[model samples]
Target: MGFWDWLTGRDTPPPAPVPEVDPAPTEGDILASLDGVDQLISGGALPAVVRSRAARVTRLVRQTLPRLGSLGLGSYDSYSVVATATDYLPEAIGAYLRLPRDWADSRPVENGKTPLLLLIDQLDLLGATMEKIYDAANSTDAAALITHGKFLQERFGHSPAADLNVPTPPSGNSPDPFDLERP
Candidate 1:
């Protein structure tokens, strides 16, 4: 808020209100929340990045429905993951939804990014979480993948190969060198 606006009692617009969530959110509940957010994004003007993330969230919701059906909607684990990933989406979007476009786009907070940019980044993270949930549901050989992942981690998770102390060949001329004739 500028000095004049503050003096005039015109404070900057407050953020959009976040939607409420159920205590134990189900797949349907999660999807409904996503649909609500999608509609909100569509109905109003939004930044390009926000629009893109909103579109992705909608697409993910569409893709998730069938997977949820196949994975067993009653499965607590799947429901938990979906709920965890999507439950906060509306609030994340809402944080900047009601702010004036000029303020959202131009005003920088303590992090040095405008509210619009921060919202985009937050949506990106949530979108990735949703994708991971989909991947977990669709995984064909999760056990195998996990085993391999652990193996790779054990093999390469440490310091560089030089730390292993494998002997290095002498760089300068040596008294005795490998000779094909002797062999």
Candidate 2:
């Protein structure tokens, strides 16, 4: 049975929860887990794995910036290097290196806003959002949010700005390939 099936009690009772295990995972462990997920997402090819993980790591840097403070500097550089190394996958690496610049140029800026804007755009990727959610949910505020409280409800429950509509992608002049394929 799959891991999810077992966890949801569809396959078998979860082996009795081991009493109070360590919650913190080492960096090596985290990277190993990421590597496995990268492989699954990109097949067994090393180049594909590197490209996929670099994209994921870039997203992670963006979403965690608020929490990272100054520690993100080295992490950002390492990710960039991984994205640029051509010995493994020259084309993929080149593509990854190009992303930050392209994303930067495309972002709107009024008065010399920092590159953080580009990072925020990167955070729009799902992996970054998921990381932020995970980090936030683990903080001390998690319990406060879970328990009923007026402050919590007022602060997080409603925001007019949150409802603002963003522009959508323009439709293409040509018919979609999928539409043409239909009988």
Candidate 3:
């Protein structure tokens, strides 16, 4: 080492820590995670705002779950639903829950918002996203119903009623209302 470096007591740099990332959850995992989050939300003594928003996210996820097939198994919307359920919503709530209630609700952590406010904003975003995903999933069925109705109308809507000619009794000779003798 140089004299100046030695005098300065320079040392080896510290190693950078790697960020920990959770693996992407599967569809089944996503569903299970939603259930878990539901239990957490219901079981915990969270504020009304937190509980309500959490409910909205879980409800949307459940409503959209069965229709994910219609959205295409691996498509972006499907993936979004899964990620929100398994990652975003859970992580946001979990982080807020980890903090003490008074401090989380009162102390501004970032951008002039308390942890509670931050969490609410995050949950709101998640809820809105899930709402969109729900609508997209349901649109598949709605579109099919519309298409089928259109098909039915095309096949039957414009056809004329069949003409059945009932011969009127010989003009001015009609006698019997119920029955007439036939020659």
- Could you tell me every candidate's TM-score relative to the true structure? 0.54, 0.22, 0.69
Candidate 2 residue-wise lDDT, 35-125, digit = tens: 5444433643223434455556544633443443323434553333233221222343333345565454455554565343433333234
Off by over 4 Å in 1: 1-23, 68-81, 84-86, 141-183
Q: For model 2, give the 10-residue run with minimal summed lDDT.
A: 81-90
Better candidate by TM-score, 1 or 2: 1
Per-model lDDT: 0.73, 0.46, 0.86
Candidate 1 vs candidate 3, TM-score winner: 3
Number of clashes recorded per candidate: 0, 0, 0
lDDT of 3: 0.86
Per-residue C-alpha lDDT of model 1 across residues 91-127, encoded as one tens digit per residue: 7777787788798899998589998888888778767
Instruction: Sort the candidates on lDDT, descending order.
Output: 3, 1, 2
Assess the local accuracy of residue 54 in candidate 1 as a C-alpha lDDT between 0 and 100. 70
Residue-wise C-alpha lDDT for candidate 3, range 38-120, written one tens digit per residue: 88899866898899999999999988888888899889998888888887888898888899889999998898999999989
Candidate 3: worst-modelled 10 consecutive residues by lDDT: 159-168
Q: Is candidate 1 or candidate 3 better by lDDT?
A: 3
For this target, which candidate reaches the highest lDDT against the unseen true structure?
3
